[model samples]
Target: MSSKVSLLISIILHAGVAFAQGPAFERTPLFILEKNRNPENIMVIYTQLDSECRVQKKRGGSEKVVFDFYWLMKRKDFKQVNPIIKKEIRSRLELLPSNDTHSFSVMMNDLKELDTDIKDFKLIVTANKKKGNCVTESILKLGESDQNKKVKLESIYAESKGFLIPTVISVTVNGIDAETGAKVTRKYMKK
Candidate 1:
């Protein structure tokens, strides 16, 4: 076989392997309050709804929202993943009958206490309900240099996506707002 043929065969095999590994996971961004501040030490905010408490407008019913927040760090080998700052909120959904969706901002508090000097890590937020589980994950890259950046929070929506079926629960991690800061409380009403 010629040298060119062998090279082409090797390239094809590598491409196949890459495709088999699967596409990258989508990440939501966490807004950092101050520039040049350490991402781990600073306050980061994202929006999420109560997993149990969602208003299914199309279908009239009750929804249960359970919020679970975890911090996933890729180990040195890159294959191993570990969880940190694992918190489970037992709060129930304050339901509203007439609303189509429920949205709110969630603040990630007490990150400095983790005690691990990780330059970067992934934030995974999971909402579990009677219908199904919904998850929103984001990667936070904290480098050694002071980049002096501020992260802004934006609204995100989750849908049941079924015609006859109602959404069990939907949580939107609205991005952090530097001006308003983390919301202390939110109210949901019923139809």
Candidate 2:
């Protein structure tokens, strides 16, 4: 039909336009988790992958995302956390700019994956079991009717043994192929 042909042409044109505009690197905050007791400490995750060329210009960089972890602490003070530990492990990765303990930026790349080298990494919750209102990664599509709905983070389990540990978060990302329109997803876990 003529309508179908017009739609196909439109898609081709849009694809061409997108191609003409160089790679648009962007970061989209997809999920997060907060410490059980300390509200000031939270792990924010971004699902967008910054390309190799974009990251390694100055030096070597981390490429792929690997594992989700939590830095367990008994006290609210993060000054005790080591700065070198963030990127010391050859095959590990964690948030960087060591000065900021409150909100850490994920420092990673694509070719090589990253893992958070936390000694006592644990899960705060999941879809079924939850210690408190926590976070994990899930690829989801927003339905037309659900677009405006807001999901609330509720804390049901309030009891902690005086230890303020962050909620367990997982590593996962989703994308769509520019050429094929097929959906793509990647997740990394420890052996």
Top candidate when judged by TM-score against the true structure: 2
* TM-score, candidate number 2: 0.24
Q: What tens digits encode model 2's per-residue C-alpha lDDT throughout 66-137?
A: 223223232122132344533342223343332221122333322122242322221111111124211222
Residue-level lDDT tens digits of model 1 in 86-155: 2112112111122233332233322222333324333333222333533232222222332312223232
Candidate 1's C-alpha runs over 4 A off are 1-66, 74-85, 88-102, 105-151, 154-191
Question: 49, model 2: CA deviation in Å?
Answer: 3.4
lDDT for position 75 in model 1: 8
> TM-scores of the models, in the given order?
0.20, 0.24
lDDT of 1 at 21: 9
Backbone collision tally, model 1: 19
RMSD of each: 18.9, 18.4
